[model samples]
Target: MAFDERALVRGPQPAVPEIVPYDDGWPDRFEQHRRRIAVALGSRAHEVEHIGSTSVPGLGAKDVVDVLVVLDDPDDEAAYLTDLERAGYELRVREPGHRALRETSGRRVNVHCYAAGDDEITKYRLLREHLRAHEDARRTYEDAKRALAGREWPDMNHYAEAKGPTIHRLLREAGWTGAL
Candidate 1:
């Protein structure tokens, strides 16, 4: 199936990504949603982790809780997408090997579904763990995010792309060997 990248952009394009101070409640919120997702996905959810900036304590981020759900077969959307839909998560982006969903329960969320053993999964886990253990790196990342958040962006995707370089550098500094 051909993936339409443009379809990922929902609603009017944002002038810039909304970045906010980290909330102390973010972790609790993630835990709450994690349980719900586990219930929704059952055994298909091999692993569900709290990722992104919200997972890092004291790090400022957009007020969205990002969760990474590792499935046995991510491409088999029919097996789990409907389950998420029933749980109030609306599918937003359908890329080649990834899928994104937004929660409709007033709380903001971005659930990233990926196949087990996917390299991107390793990257996300490494970054999150690295940031949690290294204070200096976390501060540096927070500063960069604050700076980038001020710039005007064509859309959310553009804003995300802008952070790629900084993320790559941080990953290297974190001793990531670029291997899955």
Candidate 2:
């Protein structure tokens, strides 16, 4: 489903993302969150994997660790949302087919939840893997990100939106042709 503003739990907030150099600690952070999510959801957490720029080694990102958790049914929030909350995540986005929660304290980690078979899951993996294997693509993406980060934005989403073209282009280079 399309993203709805109403799905935003904390409402809109202005942002000029601070994209930083790749950190050697990013993978550890992802693993920490992954473990916490696994324990919280138990068998419900079908799979938990790291995604996004931080997941690709030597790639600069927003200093936030991005993780993806595949659930049997993410729409049924009652099943996993509270557990995540109790474990220190707050609902950030709740669009259909997907949900996003961020670390309540530092907001350093973002957990993107999706139901099994969601196309986004595949897109994320493809891009992450592609970026990991291709140094040139990773450099191109990191450069695009640093350039975009220098501008102002009404919302963090805008910064992300600005990166769409570059992202889709790289995805296509990775052979992804699915709708954005």
Candidate 3:
């Protein structure tokens, strides 16, 4: 019989590690995760995109690739959940705000799956794009994240929440008039 290494690992899994800032390997890391998700979801995914600090060069980040797998039919999310589960991602949480934010966790990956046409993707893209083009915004965002990482909230959500001020401030400066 073949040995299943993952099954042999015991105990409740550890929490995702603290943010590690920018690393040169971030893009390749995202590519590997993207391929895995793409193979698993096949046609169900309209697109899997990199949309976070890791996607922007020279920006320090949490060392995790934030990917958005956009599905065409919002009502059919339940169907894809099973496939995602099979792909080694454990469902983390579903955003109460729009129901479009579904977080998943893997050994080294944190994925936020959203429905196509959802504003979540748009906001992420806009923020990421704006930050990439604007040096001041990138530096400010990086400094804010590092400061929050030092505090080290109980989990990722709190960390994200703590960074909201910087995010909002940048968005405002970028002329993002809130989620369109």
Candidate 4:
């Protein structure tokens, strides 16, 4: 199903762009969220991976931990959303093949929910792993992010969209030939 890009804007927009130095505790924070998500979903959580800038060491980010959770049936929101809500994760974005939840307190987290074998999931993991293994690519990405962060954006989505070219270039260098 083709998703409306506008639907991705379900969350509150940041008033200003904010990018900070890499936090050494990002991995620990991710692990904490991972554990919480695991317990919330139990056996339904097939895979949970830390992605995005925070996942890359020394990469400056918005201090938000991005996590990807692959499930056997992501569309079955009732199976997991309720539990996650009970655990304090507010459902922010809900699309045909994806769902995103944000933690209301403590360290920030974005839990992306996707169906098993979704290409989007694969792309995220591949990009994350590639960045981890290639320092030059990681540096380039950080530079691009830093430059973009200096600009004003109407929302987080706009900021994310502004990073598209650099991201796509990195993905191509990392062996992605599929359409963006």
Candidate 5:
């Protein structure tokens, strides 16, 4: 399905949520969520990776941990959600063609589960790895996030799109030619 890319760049929208930049406790939080999700997904879950800003140390973020889970069969997410609910994660957003994503009770996480061979997960990993490997790019990304956090955009997607140009520039510099 095509994402509403315009949801970010066009007209007036709802006020963006407040972004709280925090310390490196984010990864620990991700680990906590990861273990629970892993147990919930069982064998169907191939791998769970920490993505998004919180995964990067010293980066100012919206205090959310974005995780990507690669599953053996993406269609079998239902089998996992039952256990996920038990583990305190709630079904938040549904992007049918991409992945079945969930959020934690505290609303501090975004857990995305996709099929094993999906390039979405790979792309996320690649961008993350690229940022991690390049100090300049990482710093640039952090600064951009900090600056954008101050602007009151319509929503998280808007905020993300606002950072798109900078991110894309860095991506190009890092030789990241994958889909964004």
Candidate 6:
């Protein structure tokens, strides 16, 4: 099934993403959430990793921490969903192989759930690693992101969608041959 946005989401339109300069505190923020998530879900969290622009040092981003929570079976809600909710993440997207949640306190945090061995998960890692290791890729991505930030978007998803092409290009440049 397609993903559904059910909670902690804003109105349907004009969601402007403000890309901010890289903050030294971003990692700490992610670690704080990661620890809480660990206490909430325990080993089922498999891996609680920092993803997205905020994960990369020196890259400007929307200031939301993107977290990747790898689960053995993301579609099995009974396994980890309620626990995550209890920990403060509100479900935001539910789809075939993944789920998305956000911090309930309006803090800038997004949690993505994906099953083990999911190709998309690998993409996230690859993109993050590429940006970290390559200065040129990071600058190009940051430039694209800044260019797209603050424009009117029907949903914050649109802002993310606008950055897709650049991401794919960078991914290719990184020698990833997987389907886009």
| Candidate with the greatest TM-score versus the true structure | 2
* Residue runs of model 4 more than 4 Å from their true location after superposition: 1-5, 8-12
The segments of candidate 3 whose C-alpha lies over 4 angstroms from its true place after superposition are 1-17, 73-77, 96-106
Candidate 3 per-residue C-alpha lDDT over 16-37 given as tens digits, one digit per residue, 9 for 90 to 100: 4455757888888889878988
Of models 2 and 4, which has the larger lDDT? 2
How accurate locally is residue 82 in candidate 1, as Cα lDDT from 0 to 100?
96
Better of 1 and 2 by TM-score: 2
Q: Give the alpha carbon lDDT tens digit for every residue of 90-157 in model 5.
A: 65545553443446456778777787777767667766887878778778888887777665765565
Every candidate's lDDT: 0.83, 0.89, 0.70, 0.83, 0.69, 0.88
Using alpha carbons, what is the TM-score of model 2? 0.95
All candidates: CA RMSD (Å): 3.0, 1.6, 8.2, 2.4, 4.0, 2.6
lDDT of 4 by residue, 22-136 (tens): 9999999999989998988888898888999899987788989999998877678877889988877887777788888889785389899999878888788778888989989
Question: What TM-score against the true fold does each predicted structure earn?
Answer: 0.89, 0.95, 0.80, 0.90, 0.80, 0.92
TM-score-wise, the better of 3 and 6 is 6
Off by over 4 Å in 1: 1-4, 7-12, 105-107
lDDT of 3: 0.70
lDDT of 1 at 42: 89
Residue pairs clashing, model 3: 21-61
Error of 1 at 125 (Å): 1.0
Please rank every candidate by lDDT, starting with the best. Answer: 2, 6, 1, 4, 3, 5
Query: Candidate 6 has what TM-score?
Result: 0.92
Error of 6 at 62 (Å): 0.6
What's model 1's overall lDDT? 0.83
Estimate candidate 4's alpha-carbon lDDT, on a 0 to 1 scale. 0.83
Comparing 3 and 5 on TM-score, the stronger one = 3
